[model samples]
Target: MALNFYGLDLIVASNIGTIKHVKYNSNPNKKPDIKQLQRIKELEKGQGITCMTWADAEQTKFIVGRKDRTVQTFNLITDEFSDTKSVDFGEGKLQSVSVFGESIFGAVESGVIKIWKSNTSDEHLLNTGGPIEKMKHCSYNSSIIATGGKENDLKLWDLEKRTTTFHAKNVPHDWLQLRVPIWVSDICFLPENNGNVVAVCSRYGAVRLYDARAQRRPVCNVDFKDQAGSCISLGHYDKHVIVGTGRGLLNLVDLRKKGKLSKSYKGAVGAITDVMSQKDANVVVSTSLDRHLRIHNAESKEIILKQYLTSKLTCFLLRTVDSFIKQEDGEITIKQEIDDSEIKDEDEPDQEYDEMFDNMEIIREGISSKIEKNIFLEDKTKDVTVSKKKMKSEAKKRKGNDTINDASISEDLIDSPKKAKLDKEEEKVNDEDIDQSIIKLLRSTEKLKRKLLSKNKKKKAKSLFYK
Candidate 1:
């Protein structure tokens, strides 16, 4: 009630007088989140809230009815309670509240309607009954109201005329020809219906739509399977009304003439206490004794948001406009819901980022694939050694060459056995300056062998031995 919602917009009140504002997630895959929560400090330990309604369209002021048998006016702007329009009914708790024609009305379960800001001496209007279960102020006509309760059938009242305009008769009979006891738990006036069409839910799981201008009995009748229907709500464009049951069931029911029931929204684990639908969208919200507030996409029958409020939610109000509702100036308007498939592309890639990606270099191959081309797998890896047979073959071919010296051929032959395992770089020694003496030849051979042994230690010392 904290300037939270004007209707189907936001703000839920729990049994302990705590108000919470929640935001809906249009994506069914993600959960809804709670935005704010506040407890009414003035409400004491023993009091119980029975009713809540916006006192003005600006959402600056609101009304609260408590089990203490008092109806109080609260100001959202000042965040305080005012005594000007507050009233102590002195009996039963108020079940319904309405602000219309510049007067405030508090209707009690005892069939008494207390009118504030009245010019007449008689401030309280009485129905010819002792108790009423539910009462709804007509949306299309502020002067008209609808009421129903235990043993009391649905009735429409004209506040200006101070008379009952229509009374609904009991359902004719069952297949067994027995009576269907009356126990209407909640009533909702259909939008744009001139206050003549209403949707009602009974404690016996019956959902009935009444067209006052057409007939006294219900025009369309449907039963909620295995769950007692407790509350109902209608939206501006909805061909159906969302119904809440005593056992935590919420579903849209096509209750017009030639209508059928819609799919069920699954989540709550306790009795549903209240339900509301956004006027312009297929978004519906419900509260249950399970302490959870759930919003559903009525068209797809999916839950858009589910938030735990930490208290048994009894009732809530929301605006049909966006979350930034101008609650203080007039009725807070809630924004329309966006479907998941039709969500805006707000998360699209940035233009600069796309340009950077397009400008990046594209490599033909990865480094891993070229591990052996210009790179080696390990640091210890070396080239393949030349075969000893290949060295002998090359030396034989060079010995037969025309410009070779006999002494040079002898030096090469002397070195071939020791240098057989050497690499090509180590085999390039210049022996053209040899003296051709046997002692000199043996000395040169020893020097060449020592140098080759020091350079390529990978070949064992014995492999370089002169045989």
Candidate 2:
């Protein structure tokens, strides 16, 4: 994704062997217009794009790791894809690729990690371990990278020092005494934490937060409880994390609240494969195995836009910029919208099947009128009550003490079981009516005899001394 002087543009690399370019419409007056996304160009990659990262500081060139065990660079200026560069790490499948300053880092399924010097083709093999599925370079410090996977756990490496910086320790066993499995599917470094904090979601259904400087264990851990966490994306709020689950459930978790689930979004029909949030925490884009992409309002927990794509989307990046237009000499053209009266019914398209985003106007009154509703019941302090003597006198006039309702029963009496008076209508039972216990007295006697015999033998052996 490049958001330089050329305007904000997103380069979407899909697993379906296609790379699409979407440019943000640069119309200032149309800022609030829903058509912020415009398809620019699309090219067939022939091979599925596995991983990608910016290859240069200018954001003009981006390197894409492919399923063919090779990396290719796409130049935004030229709009051309470069020839594939071979990965020598046992030709394993590329799991992730990251660019750090003047070097390119890649992790493969064969447990090989390599970094190539940006200026030359000189490849340097770093440390190797279990298959890595996710590798993210720190946003603030490009020299730091975080890697995690099944059995691999979370580990941080510093390219500058050429050594492992942090080694994550597995979380302790749960209350059930079962070891928690480590299968980190997605990871994101906290942008506001100066690279000291990172959040990761595991296929084992947990969102864990780690503070590298604190301890090896996660500072906070939360489980989805219903479905495995498929992917995770950081929200606009520093402590907020948006996680997509295997059950198509989207949950917003707040780290400050002990990683409690703050809100949930519905509408996905299949397992959520990827999730990415716009700069606005309120807007979230998600892709699911249902072959659809959906944009949701995080606060409302409602889907605002949904589109059925041609193939399953493995990942996506949303690049947004400040109002796309650059002002000129005071004169501005305002595109007027067609009045509802002018649009004839016959000219209107069938919108029942239209899945495109619609421009709608929303008027916000105030926060109190919106999300902050009456969280508590009306106060009982204003309620009036009759005197105990008055109530008792009224009850007596109704029908003596028998008039008391079940709700008025004393707490002690309610707790105690009442003795039932057997009448002629009540059924009587004899000893035969009850079922006897199934335990056999003979079996118990035999078991007791065996235990006694063993105990006697052990006592005699102890008496004979330590031979």
Candidate 3:
């Protein structure tokens, strides 16, 4: 798939207990602008923002779930935390929160889900089970919600009926006859099926797609080796979903191909806590335990922008660029200036590598000495080649002259066999002498090379001693 998103605007929550509003421009020269939106700044991530979801259709307000089991409303226009009255969920981590109609649906990690109307007094309490990891409301049908967690299989709940509509059955036993355990970490409803088809990722590193009408078991289950998926988001393309793994791996999985991985993303160093795609855009925003926010273009699968928020992040919400709050009547709006520290100099080299090169010691010989040695070797080769060529030429001339003299001797002394034979023997002697001279020259070149090398080595040794 191609990542076609031009820009990114989103909210990220760090595990260090901070919520940052990030506005990113596609321009390379400009850095992503981050503004702290949290009223309370602390030194921990769990207690700040654990989960987030948009509260309204206009993407103005969103629901924030905290570690202390409290659900709060945050509006982008007002830029203030409202409806902050804490809930009494006893003692458990707040998993997720979503708005359905006038009532708000909040799920806790302790498996306690509280449902109550907005701007009301009494709230309805329902205990689904223990240790719920994720609870998400289907955008297609507001009343429908999905819940899954560790040891908790995927289940669909109808708010109006207050009944479980679909319960997913686990995969069959493995080859060793061992039953696979259930550990659903995140749930996402596919918009294509009108909330009938759903996708869920587990801590076991598997992404499964279940069709409520087709069967209880997952029709497509793709398992990633050595990487457990912590969160899942719908992909920009159809039948595709982006899965952020527990070991800092972000992968795009195709639902149509039995969970085949289409693309893998880079730049996350810590386990990804959440990955979300902007509606109607190919941009994907992910939060990780590494205390940074990264925006990826899903189509290109390249990390276009990265911002160090200095919080071990848990979750985030992707707000499109068009959804930015504008100046309303009687409302104050001022452009915030970004600090120099917030802008990352990506072109600068790492300090460690720079120091290493700067402190490096030069142990090799001087450059001039190296150059001289090279020149000597080059001259040595040329001299040997020239000598060999001269030797060959001289040998050929001797052989030609000897052949001519032999022919003249035979023609001049046709009757005297002994005389001609003597002449021929003398010519053979001359040829042998020429061959010996050539052999001597070749042998002398080898000796000369050995002497030159020995002299050079001695000079080098003397130079080292003097130094």
Best by lDDT: 3
Which residue pairs of candidate 2 clash?
Answer: none
Clashing pairs in 3: 1-299, 2-299, 3-299, 3-300, 15-45, 15-312, 16-44, 16-45, 291-311
- Each candidate: RMSD: 20.1, 21.9, 14.3
Give the per-residue lDDT digits (tens) of candidate 1, residues 135-249: 8888789888888888888888888887899989888888999998889999988777788888888889888888888898889888766778888887434558778887787
Give a tens-digit lDDT track for model 3, residues 1-467: 22223256677776646677776767888766667776342334346677788887667788887777667788887878778747676357777888878888788778888888767776877777657988888988888899988888998999888888999999999999999989998888888577899999988888999999999999999999888889898887788899999778889899996569999888888998988876455677888888778878877878877877654788777654343445558783543534445665442213434566799997656567557766876786677678767867876787688678667765656667887687678768866776776677668767866877897788878896756
Which candidate model has the greater lDDT, 1 or 2? 1
Estimate TM-scores for all models: 0.63, 0.62, 0.67
Question: How many clashes does the backbone of model 2 have?
Answer: 0
Candidate 2 per-residue lDDT over residues 1-467, each given as its tens digit: 32333233455555655555543333332211121111213334446777777765545567888787778877654557764577777546788887766667788876678988756977778764777768778877778888888888998888877788888999988899999788888898888567889999998888999999899999999887768888888885778889999999888889884779888889998888778777533567787878677777766767666655545666665544322332248753333334334533331122312433354545566545213222211121112122334444553464344325434767775555551222111213321121121123334445655666686678778885744
lDDT score, candidate 1, position 134: 83
Root-mean-square deviation of Cα positions for candidate 2 versus the true structure, in angstroms: 21.9
TM-score of structure candidate 2: 0.62
Model 2 residue 321 distance off true place after TM-score fit, in angstroms: 4.7
